[model samples]
Target chain A: MTLETTLAAIGPADEQAMAAARELQGRLTKPAGSLGVLEELSVRLAGLAGTCPPPMPEPAAIAVFAGDHGVHAQGVTPWPQEVTAQMVANFIAGGATINAFARQVDASIMVVDVGVKIPLHGGENLLEANIRRGTHDLAVTAAMSEDEALTAIQVGLSVAGALVEGGAKCLLTGDMGIANTTPAAALVAAFTGASPADVTGRGTGVDDETYERKIDVITKALALHEPDPAQPITTLAAVGGLEHAALAGFILGAASYRVPVIIDGVIAASAALVAAALAPNSVAAMVAGHRSAEPGASVALANLGLTPLLDLGLRLGEGTGAALALPLVASSVRVLREVATFDSAGVSEK
Target chain B: MTLETTLAAIGPADEQAMAAARELQGRLTKPAGSLGVLEELSVRLAGLAGTCPPPMPEPAAIAVFAGDHGVHAQGVTPWPQEVTAQMVANFIAGGATINAFARQVDASIMVVDVGVKIPLHGGENLLEANIRRGTHDLAVTAAMSEDEALTAIQVGLSVAGALVEGGAKCLLTGDMGIANTTPAAALVAAFTGASPADVTGRGTGVDDETYERKIDVITKALALHEPDPAQPITTLAAVGGLEHAALAGFILGAASYRVPVIIDGVIAASAALVAAALAPNSVAAMVAGHRSAEPGASVALANLGLTPLLDLGLRLGEGTGAALALPLVASSVRVLREVATFDSAGVSEK
Candidate 1:
């Protein structure tokens, strides 16, 4: 489906289903409003699914959209750009942290070459959806053309659709891009109207000198772009990575399909800002999986009215947060579907 | 092991292992201190286990200690007193919310009839550890005799030992009682030096009238007992439930063995207070699984210097919160053990 059609079709969550879920929560054999956020989350999922006790969000998929960033030339992060491709290879070879976490949670991983500068040969689990060689250095110029940004977004949309069609009840956003956090902080500042210094954080353990440079890079990019929040595409092309654009499309696609999308850290949160700008209602399908250690993540999540399910101080960006959260998400749904109501359990309610 | 010997044997966590774990965290292929609380948690676990990347806490066991409370006569909760025994049966039948959550986390459940008023027959997973029929009315007199309280604590200590011996690596605390929250709140206030009004909360979704009455009941019980924080056993016998005393023993047992104990809600937190008072070092083995909606839970947790892993507003007491947190706990350890170090992954360090 076209991005425009998906955005146009996005609607608010189903109020009737939400009410049903709330009433059901009260009837469960526990104290009223005792399950706390899990009770609220289950109701929200019901609204998204348009049913009480919504379908279990199982057979989860984590899409690791790999890319390279021209900002890597700015010496923003200590890691080499080639590490993105190497990590992607590690992910496919089941040697990365995300792979280990996904295996534990029974989640499948899909790697998409959205804009990797290196030529990634065909692999069993890799999707060759490269939109370009890599984004231009956002500190010096717009990261990508509007068309390139849109193509990357469509790649995310297609991946989301394919995963959902393949019976993935939940989609998790993952990303692998060198110096990606530079553009991520810039995008978050552009969308959330936060100052670059407030949102920019030390990415990948930068030294004091490199940390200051990273912030300066983001500040310069925002000044050069003067990104309009109303024009998400222009802002995205100006300061966002290809993977970020794709993540936004993936979120939009999940919203169109009424499936839950568990967003990862700073990169995914910044992408969510772009998705929310395009279709505010799409935020209904999003769940902040965990609190990223990055300062920008808190700003983005707060602006989106989302509270992360876990806050274990995670900053790894390869959908690691989402994979760690998979079991909690599944448990939330199981609480709704499997927990017996007071009447069913023959227990008196307070 | 005897309670006194166990308490005496409990020592500080292994500082050598903790330092090693911290050094290992720095080598992981992510930003320094990027994993946030998980990194801290892993180091803590390593200290407890006396090794870096401590053994995985799997094959978890949730001990649901069922009991009745004389506070049921105080009109605190609307539910009938018989529901406690009935729910115990439901737990054993695997029909309760805790059962469902335990299944989701692949953890086993064990129901202990610590003080159920009614005599329970044979059940496959039920442990006949009943100390007495139930505790006396706390508002009028001591909840249990000193001997009864000691016996109940021993029951918990034994359960912890048995579970650890049976190949379970982690122990989660769960409890069932009709008006247990009344004692839980009182225990928390007595231990934490908080005022009854500040620590007391509506239990099992009580009406305004019942909430006010509940607070009054706790106030009156405290006035009569005048529990001494310096004498934890006195406080426990004066106002705590049988299951609460046992849970405290369970926590102490785990600490003595250097095994992790994930405490559930207010009841478990209250028990933790007793455990901490009895053996201050026991808190090292404890992890607040989630923030209980009950105000007393927060006060107890804060006093213990423990931050819950999950705070989904859960007030359900049957180890539901701990069950939800099991996967996250496993992931925390797994991240430390499985995530490739920077040098091992051939990734450049910042």
Candidate 2:
């Protein structure tokens, strides 16, 4: 489906299903409200699926949207831009952390070359969806044109649709882009109306000097563009990477299909801000996988009103956090689908 | 092994293994402390196993110790005393929440009848470790004789040893005893130096009147026995149930074997307190699975200096919370063992 159609079709979760799930939770043998957030999560999933005891979110897929950033020229991050493509290759070879985690959780991984500067060879696990060679230097100009941003987002939407149609019950956000966190900080600061210093953080363990430079880069980009929150497309085009725009589209597409999207770290969180701004209801379909160590991630999650399921201080962005959390999402549903009620178990109730 | 020998053998985790795990974690491709709490968890697991990237804690076994409580006569909880035995039947039939969650996590469940009022039939998953019919009412007298308390703890230690010898890598604590929280509150208050009113809570959805009555019951029991925290065995004999004492022994046994034990809700937390008091170092092997909704659980966890991995507001006495947390524990190890280092992945460092 087109980005516009997907965004337009997004609606609020079914309140009736939520009520039914809550009632069923109460009937389960556990004390009322004892399962904590899992109970609430199951209820929300039920609402999203429009049924009580929603199907277990299994056969999950993590789409690693690989891109390059023109901001790499700013020396914002110490890592070479080629590392993004190299890491994508590692992901495709099942040698990365996300690959290991996804294997452990029995989930599949797909690497989408949304904006990688280098061309990647076709592979069983690789998707060629490159929108451009890479984003323009955000410090000097807009990151991408509005149409380019939209096309990149459509790529994410298309991937989401393909995964769901391929029987993936859940979608996980993974991203790869060098100096990507620079634009991510800008997008978060623009969307949340926060100061750059309050949101920018060392993307990949930068030293004191590079850290300060990273902050200056984001601050300069924001000052030059002054992207409006009312115009999410403009904000994305001005400061976001191709992968970030696509991830936002992926989130919206998952919501349109009424499937839960487990968002990874800072990059995904910033993109979620864009997605939430575009289709406010899409936030309901997103589950913050973990609390990223990045300062900007906290601001983005706060703005989205999402509580991460795990907070092991993760900052990696290649859907590793989401992959680690897949079992939790699955268990939350299993509690509803597999657990017997007090009556069914013939156990006494309080 | 005897309970005394198990307790004597429990020692601090291997510092060398911990250092190795921490060093390995630093070399991983992610930022130096980006993995957050997960990095710490991996180190702790390493220490517990005395090896870096410790064996994956799989083939976990949850031992649900079922019993009856004399405190039921005090009207502490709304749940009927017979529910303990009935729930044991449900557990054996694989129809309880714990059963469902254990199945989802691929963990095995074994119900140990340690102090049930009614005689239970032998079953494939049932263990007859009965110490007595039940404890005496703590408000009127010591809950159990000192000898009986020790014997029950030995039962738990034996179960732990058997499970470990049978190839279970992790042990999860589960408990079932009507009015069990009454004694749990008293035990927590005694160990933590908290007042009964501070630790007692509605066990199974008690009404306002019953809540007050539950608190009063624990307060009176504490006043009558005046159990000394310095003398854990005496304190357990005075107010703790057979299941709680056994769970404490189970914790010690797991520690002696260098196996990780995931403590469940309030009952398991209280037992952990007793175990910590006995061995002083067993806490190193115990992982607080989740934050219990019960007030006493918080006190117990605080006394043990343990932070729960999950805070799902779960008050369930079964191993349901532990089952849900199993994946997180497994993932923490997987990250350490499987994730490629910066050099290995050829990814540039900051």
Which run of 10 residues does model 2 chain B get worst, by summed lDDT? B29-38
TM-score of 2: 0.95
Q: What DockQ does each listed candidate score?
A: 0.62, 0.63
User: What is the C-alpha lDDT profile of model 2 across A247-276, one tens digit per residue?
Assistant: 999999999999999999899999999999
Q: How displaced is residue A84 in candidate 2, in Å?
A: 1.8
* Clashes per candidate (backbone, < 3 Å): 2, 2
Worst 10 residues of 1 chain A by lDDT: A341-350
For each candidate, C-alpha RMSD in Å?
Answer: 2.0, 2.0
In lDDT terms, how accurate is model 1? 0.90
TM values, all candidates: 0.96, 0.95
